[model samples]
Target chain A: MTVQDIGFGTASAQPLPAQKGPVTAARQRRTWTIYAAMCVAGLLPTLLGASASLQAAGIGLWLPGAGFLSVGGWAAVLFPLTLALFVFSLVAWFWAGMVLGPVIVWLGSAALAGAMAGDTVWAGGPYAAAFATAGIGYAFHRRNVRLRDAALAKIAPRVAFLDASLAEVRAQAAEIPDPATREMTPTDLAALRYLLDRALQPVTEWGGFDIIDQFQPAALRYQLNHMGFALGIAQTAYVPNFHGYMGQAQRNLIDKYLLRKVWGYWVYESCWGHLNFTNWDPAARDNIMLTGWFGMHVGQYMLASGDRRYLEPGSLTFRLNAKTAYVHDFNTIIGSVKTNYDSAEFGLFACEPNWIYPICNHYGLASLAVQDAVTGSDNVRRYAPGWFKMLNQEFTDEAGSIIGLRSQHTGMPIPFPTGEVAYAAFQNCFAPGSAQQQWAIARREIAPAIHPDANGKMRISLPGKGLDTGNYKSGHTGSFASILVAAKEFGDAYVAEAAQNSLDSDCGLEIRDGVRRYTGGSNDTNTYAILGQLMQAGDFRRSFTQGPHAPSRTGPVLEAASYPAVLVAQAISDGDNLRLVLYPGAGEGTQTLGLERLQPGRAYTVTGATTDAVTASPDGRAGLDVMLCGRTAVTVTPA
Target chain B: MACCAFAVYLLSQLLWPLRWLRDRLLVAPAVTASASVAWSPASVAAPVARKWRWKPALLLLLAAEVFGLGVAATAASVSAPAQPSVEFLDALHGSICSAVKGSLS
Candidate 1:
């Protein structure tokens, strides 16, 4: 049913208003008079020696800079006119979307000012800047406001219903006593296992493909990181084939984003294409928001598989333009990260063209720790001190929580939610000390709103009243996932279980092809659940507190003639015994398998197959032909 | 000073058609329709019913003033050897003055 069907909007038989009006001489006269008055108001200060400061402050409301005020005499005329042009452009933006309105105002004003410049070099530069700034800023503001308002309006009815229903459920739930807490049971482990297995199954690709039109590949990068996290942790957990598959997957993701002469489009067509502002990148490329996320995924893979192939020199090359490529080994990438810390007066890297997003940066810092964990790199140890110092100085609010989306140019926090509920667990990965501090504040401030129902399922509410439709999910599934992650990391099993219970109750799930997929939630939210489940007390702590762990043997437990070809369902070896499960991803043909890493000097018999005997070569390799079918298991025992 | 101001005034007048078109396309229809609904004849008198007689006269005078300003600015700028010629302003004044003078003649 439509929103209007539920009585959300007025349903009228009245047709939409007519789209034209009659023009009259009087109207034309009025328009001219107003136009002339604006022109005169704008021109008086420019043509005559007048108080340009007064004109700027009186009409523009605020002077842009002392430099603008420094332009004395006729040169100062552009200030008030810039202000007038800005006001006009705001009205124009109610009509035009994107950068068109601002471009028009900037160019038009500059062109007009050029007439007055004579031979002056910088006559129209300030005017052009002022007009563009005002127009573009106003347009961006309008767009954000419209989005916020529309979101609030669209979700109001549903949120209201949810609030009232959830309130009643919460009230009923409160009567029941808090359930006894315990460690993760076998049942819980099974559920977690099932979720992890589901994550492994090939699914629809995540991440936005809009890099050229509007550079927001964040969704894709986020999903890739979480996917890496889920699979990376699964290596140590239950998934047998995860170690090999995850190693390959991590390599593929790293290779895909590493700006080589691959992937149909030029690197410039993607988010990474616009990397270095000082280099061949566009003016919008200097943001540090993406490096952290990419680093996190790469780091997770390296940590899990202990493969340092990515770190070796001549690993990845960044294509700047034709014949100009910057080769980046892991050290160079990590070194570039150091530059962000060194250069940042505020110790924060920008996520957007101009705005520094704390959450995205947290991912970055965590990635640095991850790098330190995998490679014997001390970049994090070197840069993190200054980072934390700058972060506290500039990004932290009065309550000690880092500000979300602060402008790097202005150093002012954008009014986006940077609450602990959204970021605490994520920060826990890179900076456990600061994360714990934030969590302490969050637990005190946010713990009260987490009300348990009769089933001990918690319903979390944001601090303020009214559906913060701007971010509706944060108080619900997002909160549950974040809390669960934090609780798991901090050894708060009770809260973690409660949060998990809430997630299970609220976010419905479905089993497809024996893979559990969240039916009611977003990919990111479900991925967050995976991350929360993957959290171990000393997972990231060992990386940050201590240093890089020694690399583990990341090769597959078993290899077939088809190297990296057949998708192995599972493979494990215990001393002299070997077990391997294979799944032919989308085929039914018989295939020969070669044992690359199985124990050497062993004789084995298939339990069900009519094979005389299969012996491992002295080099610990064996070959066997098996039918590629459902649940094919082969056991090898030393004789 | 008056010359530049007048040139800007002429520019605005010449650009009026574009402005009118923008208003018609983007702003005026919705505004006029809302006004019509809010002040329906049943609830309020028609605003256009009592027309002001001086509208035509005011429009004519304004056009003349704008034309004069554009001509004077064009003359002064052309006479000054030190002042650089702006192609945009020159084109604007040439086109607007020609169009207005032809209409008047």
Candidate 2:
């Protein structure tokens, strides 16, 4: 009381309650106690008021309506039910407005009322608002969908091109250190590059497949020839154009050759017609002659692309008895030939169901060789000696040429051309020694038909019977092309030059953009021509004896920004050293060449037209700018 | 029915219009034929036969007939006639009497 009497303010009056511990715990407790008391005092009245209201508003004031329907029994039932339905309808209308946007539901309501009740005046106002809302929403939705679709459409082509290029890069990177494409000589490069360039030209007329079962073998042959060409082109290069053409070849192999639907008519239709042209109509699951070519194409693709994706089980499904049967592996397709090899005929294959064709059997044998190369199988080596014995014993005619066609059932040679020179090179891919022997025999026997033209270029008169030409033909450019290819394989330079010269003269040679092609020839003939040009003894021997051609470990990368359009014969990299043989196809002026897959932090010296020692950039890249023209070889070596 | 169809086929061979009708109607076209079912100039000119074997379809029809006859017999046995036997007989008698009276007059 003495301090309070002297205090001027509340602080001085309260001034100083004695300090409790470090914290005023008692003071905090007292303050909270006070707050609790005040809160209870204020909230108790509100809670009591709410409780009183709950009691007072018990189901709200009773509406001024009857507790039960105040009418007779039927009226009592119907009247309240009607009233309930009315209330429900109103609730549903309000619910619809909440759910479906106020304006959209109004349109629905207006449409229904106008149509059902003929309430035209009530419909107009709501209908207008609803339509406006719907139109705006639809426009927005359409625009969003279009924008999304357009984005996808714009990205698709670029992605596809990039994907193909990346696959090609991966394929190149996967190659082992074996017979590299760059190991080929200058002659080899010229021939293979030229043939590949020709082979990549779009096959305009594939001859329709619809006529295949009509005994029209030309259409089927056309597709097979292209298949062979596509496989051949895949061996040396993975250029985008050549790689893209493989799709067509794959389609022909699967859809046309392996597809039973295309060949199914032989089962029921021919039985009705009582017509049998060949054994091709029968649905034999393990027919070697008909199916072996497909195996060859697939094996070659495996060897070329270094992609074993197709070798997985069930990658190919075939129909037997109009039901699908899984083709498990490349071995399975190749084994079709191995399993069905005519043990009785000594490894001969049937051309049709019951008829054996020595030439077609050669393809089957070649297919086996391809299988051996791709899978490390010893089929060709295992069967070759036995096959030669059987072939010589049963299939060869008196002239030391294979009999063209023989009936497997009768064991009698059908009166066919027996043998021809055009097929000798084909056998070289599988049995080179036997093929060389065969070609020698054919050359000696057919020497009488070989005549020197006025220009001294040797031309052979083709016996039109076997090669599917009309009559005994003269000036057979296709035969010349075939002979040229065989001659090259056998290393008969004299014969090859003559044949090449004759073909150039007779078939109307066309060379533009460094691509050589015969302008006036059927697709089959042109394909043979390309094959003839590309065939080299080294490539053939390596492929037949060894496994597939191993691409280089690293290669010169074209700087895409300032890349010149050039025909690259071979781009090879060996231990960070790049060697390139390229000829300008459409490109001119100076071009920049970059080295890819080089060792990082290594310096490289580029030699050819210019020599410069340069260190690889952080991304393992080193490049030189140079001027190039026809057929220049560039080498880059690490310093 | 198959026997009748075969008999009809035999008759059709002798009559030109019936033969045409038989090919057009009785014989079904070949299914899954690579070539057309109808004769072409090339096929007609060639030695290869282009005839359809219609006997299989006829045999199928015969099997259907046997099954149909069995079903008809089973259905007939399971239910009585719509009218009672006595009523049926009375109706038959009245119809006979009317026919006889008309003939006599």
Candidate 3:
């Protein structure tokens, strides 16, 4: 009959009325009034049932503000737009299914569950059915909206260059001979395997907190990830080939150790969309932070699977958006260490999640993969953490040292048993200018007046005592002498030889060890892994200075870096100082990467051929770009 | 439940072969260390009870000293500052050093 006639409302019992004559006219008015009141009350079940379903249809449309304009802006600009698109597509599928399927069957399958759960107990089947369909539909709709936004986000400028590098890198990877047989040099794979063994020893006996005091298996897990991040290669990807299948034991260790710590670290960094991330790990947080590319490690995660989901525009946009939101709300997302302190003692890291350093590695990887997928470039990426260009200009000296920008200046105090006071803003580091960006187009000579301790150990400390400028936070004390050794070894044999000669000068104690040097920058273990990564990128070395690097107290590198002729002339010509650069202009066929006994003091020439390799002449009479070769790197001093 | 699991895990470190090793090999030789703590807490003075925060652990280190084993454990895991495992080892060495110093003093 009528809407209210269907008895939608709660019916209250009074008395049934029987009215007929004018004497009962008063009773007739009373019956009519009761009907009106009943209609209003009965409207409840219908209104209550409809509101939830209405809300469900608007699912991810929920946001901070409530306005058509605000919702439109977010839909227009927010990240992971692909997610939003997918959500819409999903919603469409559900709508189609709803139209085709039997209403009774669909409602029975869906609405019955809610009815049994008392969610829609008093409501009838139609209301329950409507609510259920609308709720599920809303979920898909919201997801699609977010994904669509992601499709429109823009890549930063530095990230663009890194994308270019990825193309070059892919071409290079193809050139590498897989087998170590038949004149093929062994790739870094072997070195990596050997590294994993020594690194993965049980932490039970670890002298520090890793094994004994409040031991977090995650500490080691983070260390492993840190190693991978530093080394620029996730060993876990190649684990199957190197080790056996990852059984339960290994998986458990990874889950317990590595995954858990990352979760905790993520929680701290995310700030739960509640607190500031500044309250988290001191090592990774930036004071005035900005857009974070470091979080895009999702790319490296799914690369081996070739799934591309992790590398998709949706993922990148979400990561970048989360970074942007956090940075905007809290501090500008810059690298943490403008200055530094001793959080390491407190088992806290000094490095921040800010992208000044290794985020470049992640960005470089992402841009490379994305470009290949989207635009089809085979180039490797040259990721540049955006902070360096801005901060160095503001805080660094002509020498690029920022001692004035330490934690002490801002008075972010640190707890101490030592006499010195440590503030949060002030970092206590023993080294200045440890990490070297490879982008040094210009050459500058830096020679600090450092001296050896009574034990003959000299520590080059920038000593955060006076650094109150940019980010002089004494975070990480980095030394990539070994990494430099690897690059110099690969780039120019002379560089390796020179590095060896420098190491030889340390004599009985410090011989040529592994590919890592002593680093007290972040966690020692994590730094070790990072040190390995830096070896690949050699994060510390700029190009050669205009003049030779003169050691503060004339250390071993001075003697080792001398000319080949200088070493042999003193041996043979009996003191005729000579200088010569070995010709490596020969073809890759003849220019031997690994060979022994390159005679110094003799004549040598280099011939140029296709594909970039070096050639050696028997006599050094005439040569093409012959500077130093083989044993002459450290042996030849700079002119 | 998580605390119980973690406790079981830590407790397992002290049982069986490790305990035996601590007693026989590591704890035997360091007679000098055990003798240092032979007296009661009041006689030694300065907050002896307070010093025993992680007593079971410090006890293992102490008991191992009597068998000459903690040194082996120490030597087995000590890493140089110049190498890759320095971070893991540095904290380890600090704890070991503290344990040793606490017992010795």
Candidate 4:
């Protein structure tokens, strides 16, 4: 929905008095006049200048720099128009408290600015300010918009616990009067069941889709738009009977009939959340937050797409992918060498959730794998050759499993990494000085949670809250020094397992007396984990958390049918199992467990720094099992 | 100045006739003409008018370009170790403009 759509939600029948006030009439004229003037003056000039320089220099459309396309032609065309749109978006800031609208306008401005300069050699550095501006502005605006968008704000809260019980859930569905629906296949049905597994996971329960986060809510803000778009798109892709709704017939139906009176309430915020922690006015952006969120949001949807829609063919996306260059978790080292963005070079550090921080390499590449799955996009493909090359360089070891860096938060990088036997490792948590951290650190090495313990569960917690205001983190790009393996463990089960093991932070969220508490240690990471536990935990875990406009939720496991409802539609098209296995004190053959499940006959696994392969093996493992010096994966044959 | 350098290169990419678009039976006559018009060299050239202004414009552009060049150089130099071919090609790209300009003018 457009920015103006928010004002129409209340269904207030307030007719405008025809020219009752001259002042009002004059104000309208000025708004349009100035907007027009800017188009002719400010916008026209910027476009011409860019077009001229690019053409004259022979930079062409395929600029060698990063952000080349996103910032180029579109910038020249839409930026000026958007500046006008930004002013209009602020109406929400006035009415929606401070959460939502202004951020959209702020983001519009920054995105436009990025478009303007992304093609240049020194683009992202200077352009970083625009990103920062968008992040902070959007965050502030998010609060404002949330306030004004009452219908969206007032969605009836759902009972999440109702989702947990498998039998109860099925019985509830059976109780539904409608008997006309056809039963789906076991595969499709099973997929639906998977989504229900952790229906109560934080990201999902909150409606953010990312499912876990304190700052985000499922309401009409983030979910209504971005996540909503994803869900809606996914629904269309999966439903055989669903005719095209994007074009005329469907749009006409919605516009003429359905939406004529549909309340703007229960809408999504914006798909793109803003996080920037940079020098461009802290009030404007938080470069760390944005870079982190950007990596997460992009990875979540981009990696999920089963189609090429995620890619901009013949575009910058196809040239310099964010997946490979930015390096979300263990990205500092790779990005340090490959691109200009890094905590080492630029002071960009912020709090990102999950394990694999400081430098969680497996999660880093697994995250990139997510982007590739979305479209197998040309851009995704371009970076894959290089990304896998670099990822194995530092992250992988002699065996097939991963080897991750343990952030020296409490102290220094020990030569013998904590829990060296494993392929991937993450600090118990980044807060070495925390009251609880001493206990975690003193435990000696971090161990991969291979088997469910007495509790039959795993847990991880959010690291120390707030931005880094000190020397160590900002200097070393180590603020992520904690763990934010946001997109680790892409397709390989082994990799996924290893990556998941790193996120052994606090996971319990038991709410009491309307107060939600973050109980220590629930090592659940990834959509699969949250979805999985909620499915299995059932009523036992109820009263844990609530959903948007709902009572404290219990037993609300998402059905596998809901996979399309989460993440981007494109991601579902190209399916690749992703993982990152961290071997627990590996000696000879400890590293290759997770990757064995990969369909060897159909899949070709490569390993080592140059994506090398295993020529032969002493153990007489299948030739594919003999993963080269380092990493490997088996997959369903690539389409 | 850059416009002069890129004109030939850009034209080269578009050297082939855009016949499929115009000759296609399915395309409505109305849009086809405009589509071609949108890509015409004259239309593309018109944007240059607003850019070619006074000394300040040049200076601002020069500064931005220099900064861009510096960034390009650093990245280019860093990658030079693994791919000498790239380094050599970059050197070649740098000289192409000057070399071409000398002959064309």
DockQ of each: 0.02, 0.01, 0.01, 0.01
Clashes of each: 5, 1, 123, 125
Judging by DockQ, tell me the better candidate of 1 and 4.
1
Could you give the DockQ of candidate 2?
A: 0.01
* Deviation of model 3 at A117, angstroms: 66
- Model 1, position A594: C-alpha lDDT score: 61
Candidate 3 lDDT score at position A220: 41
Model 2 alpha-carbon drift over 4 Å, by segment? A1-217, A220-290, A316-328, A342-346, A418-423, A461-475, A512-515, A544-564, A573-576, A587-628, B1-105
In every candidate, what fraction of the native interface contacts is reproduced? 0.00, 0.00, 0.00, 0.00
Rank order by TM-score, top first?
1, 2, 3, 4
Weakest 10 consecutive residues of candidate 1 chain A by summed lDDT: A7-16
**lDDT for each candidate structure:** 0.48, 0.45, 0.25, 0.25
Off by over 4 Å in 1: A1-214, A239-242, A259-278, A281-285, A318-326, A454-456, A461-479, A534-556, A559-595, A602-615, A623-639, B1-105
Interface RMSD of each: 19.8, 24.9, 24.5, 26.7
lDDT of 3 by residue, A433-469 (tens): 1121111100011113233445564423223332111
Local accuracy of candidate 2 as per-residue lDDT tens digits, B1-105: 211232232233234345556676667563321121111222333222222245587677668665654553343333232436535644765687688779999
> How many times do residue backbones clash in model 1?
5
lDDT of 1 at A331: 60
lDDT of 1 by residue, A293-390 (tens): 66666666666555667687767565656877666666666555566766764566655444567677777677778777676677667766766655
Q: Give the TM-score of chain B in candidate 4.
A: 0.26
Steric clash count of candidate 2: 1
TM-score of 4: 0.22
